[model samples]
Target: MLRKIIHVDMDAFYASVEQLDFPELIGKPIAVGGDGARGVVAAASYEARKFGVRSAISGVQAKKNCPGLIFVKPRFERYKEISTQIRRIFYDYTDLVEPLALDEAFLDVSNNKIGCPSATLIAYEIRQRIYQELGLTASAGISINKFLAKIASDYNKPNGQKTIEPQEVEEFLEELEIKKFFGIGKKTADRMYHHGIFTGKDLKSKSIEFLIENFGKAGAEYYNLVRGIQDSPVRPNRTIKSLGTERTFDENLSSEIFLLEKLDGLVQELSLRLKKSNVSGKTVTLKIKYRDFVQQTRSKTLPYFMSDSELILDVVKGLLFQEELKDSVRLIGVTISSLNTEIKKLPFVIQLEFDF
Candidate 1:
């Protein structure tokens, strides 16, 4: 039997929630993030996007794009409260719910608790409840597999839904751009474009061997992806691999004095999370996103597993100053894994949320 998958994505989640809570901010250009010269945009409202304001861009740039843009800080606790409400609604239909982030999730309804034979109806009902109960709008995509469902969900904007029937898979993929396919990033797409593989139809014309030759290990996977043969299952009780928080700077920083100073507050945040979850690890990973958005990670595994924030900070400092950066950094994040604490089966783990 085909896996009836539904992908639910919220519309401009964080910014919309702000608008809902503060009526005066409605219909205005606003963003959620620090407004300082050293801060980066966390989320942007639809109105702000018109002026070229985007997440991860510096606040200075965002303001330059829209002089009247209002900046607000992120409130993850409040967003988590609303996300729980959304999950309760999903549980009414099926337990096969896999949350991708705080604002979007995938649901398998092939054998749903509600016994709804039509995936379209289930998606419609889910969207209506979110708006009526939470004062939020959601877009849904329904299909026979997870990959197709995710693409379909983005077809309409704000509060719309779309579904792809089994029979329409071939025609649907043929017309889609290679960039739009899941797992195909900008770097890969650029390489494919150079080879004249611009769309699904162009990809379909190539033999599997030819694709493997160009893409290496990913070639076999791409061969199946273009034909819409995705069979990855929806994982409800997904294990938490690692937990971390990150900060984006308004300006790229390359100096060690400034970078080390930034680590103090970052360590404090990581400490809080470690204490809250009661997890200790020997592996500490440091992540850096450069000016051009290229990211790199360096990690260290200590002899003992400890959740000491100061110790983690000490290790990362060595990694950072050990090598000169190729470019100034726009963002920094830290994570600890290989944990000694118990692994809990969780329905979801909050990640960076976005409408796209």
Candidate 2:
């Protein structure tokens, strides 16, 4: 039986939350992030987006795009509080919910508690409850699987929902622009264009071997995606593979002394995270992003798992000097992998009957 999947994404989540809390900021251009020259826009309101303001772009650029744009600092705790509330509403329908982030999630309602036969209606009810209970709007996509549901969710933005019936999947994909496909970024789209792959129809015409030869493993994924063959399940309690943190400097740092000082703070942060998660790893990786946007990583594996700040710092210090700096650094991060935490698989029970 075909599974029922719904993808729900809050509209401009961070910015919308700010506006919802401060009515004075409603309907105006606002960005959720620092206003400093070095600050990056964490999220942009729909009004700000109209002026070319977007997330990850420098605050300076966002300000230049919209002179009237207001910058607000991020309140992660508040966001988490709201996210928890939203998840409660999701639980009313099904337990098979996979959170992509604080603002979006995938719900498998094939065997929902509410016994709602129609996934479309479940999505609609979910959106309505969110607006009524939290004063926040959401968009939803309902389809037979996660991939199609995710794409359909974006079809109607801000406060709308779309349903892609299984019968419509083929034509919907065929005419769709290659660039609009999820996971196909600008660079990948450009490469596809060079090979005369301009739409889903074009992508479907290529043999799997041809795609694999050109794009490596990702090419096979693209081939399968175009044919709507994705079978990855929506895992509710996804395993914690790795945990780390990074900082992007306002100004580039060229000296090893300064880099080492930065590494100390990162180690402290990673250690705290490890303690919080109750997990330790044997591998420590040092990530360096140069001023030119080039990234490099150096990793070292130890004989035993370690989560102590001093030991992690020692490992980081060694990895830092193992390779000479190729250029001034713009960002640096630390990651711990090969975790000692065991993964417990969730039992899956087959649905004997479907209401639909």
Candidate 3:
């Protein structure tokens, strides 16, 4: 069956939410993140992007690029609430929804609950409703598969829609820059350029084996993409196989006490998140990286899903003890995997006050 995939992405999600709440910020360029030296740009308004201000760029540098750039602290709670509202809008059309992040998702509406034959029509309705009901704009891409749909969505962005029919796929891809291909990053684009591959036409001329030889296993993927032959499914009910968080410290630490303190904090954070999500895991993994960028991981799978911090600490401590570090630690993280979602929710007050 020819799949109908719709990729929907909110335009400048954090900045849009800011503008929604504060009408004064509507026309101005806004950057959502801290303005301090350590600050990174989390999101940028369309106005900011024109000034070369982008997400993950330093706020200090963004200010230099766009002197008029207004920086705002992120309000994650508000964004999460708005994300829930947007999700409800998607569910009204199809149950086959796969969220890529809080602001973007792909929906397979080939057989929708609303019986909408045209995915473009559904995209228009959803976009209009989001604007009318939430005062937010969205960009929608409609095509036969995920890759094409994602590319189409970004074609006409910030309150726009684009659709690519199967017949036009080849022509559409031929004119596209190789960098614009779904999975090609800046580093890969450099390699492509070095190999005389600048456009889709150049990439298409190469055999699957040639690509694999040059780009490893993903080279075959690039070959298929040039032909618009993506067969990946828009998976719904996606399982969280693992959950973890890591932080790169500004200063390297040789103190074992400080390392343990950081580990303790991570354990608490992961435990709270798992409990809140009503999921538990059987594996405990500890990751550490030295100042030299050398990294190592140690993992152990328990007999059953556990939510215990003490046990987690012991496992991590043991892992740390086994490692002989030659340099100061620059990063540390903890992860839990092999998940089980069966959880009983207790009363909020009781749950907050009591233990398992």
lDDT of each: 0.84, 0.87, 0.83
State the TM-score for model 3: 0.74
Off by over 4 Å in 2: 243-284, 287-296, 300-322, 325-343, 349-356
TM-score per model over all chains: 0.78, 0.79, 0.74
The per-residue C-alpha lDDT of model 2 at residue 201 equals: 100
Query: What local lDDT score does residue 93 receive in model 1, on the 0 to 100 scale?
Result: 96
TM-score of 2: 0.79
Name model 3 segments beyond 4 Å from true.
242-356
lDDT of 3 by residue, 139-198 (tens): 999888899999999998889999998778899999899889888987799999999999
Tell how far residue 182 is off in model 3, in angstroms.
Answer: 1.1
* Candidate 1 residue-wise lDDT, 93-121, digit = tens: 98889887778899988877786788899
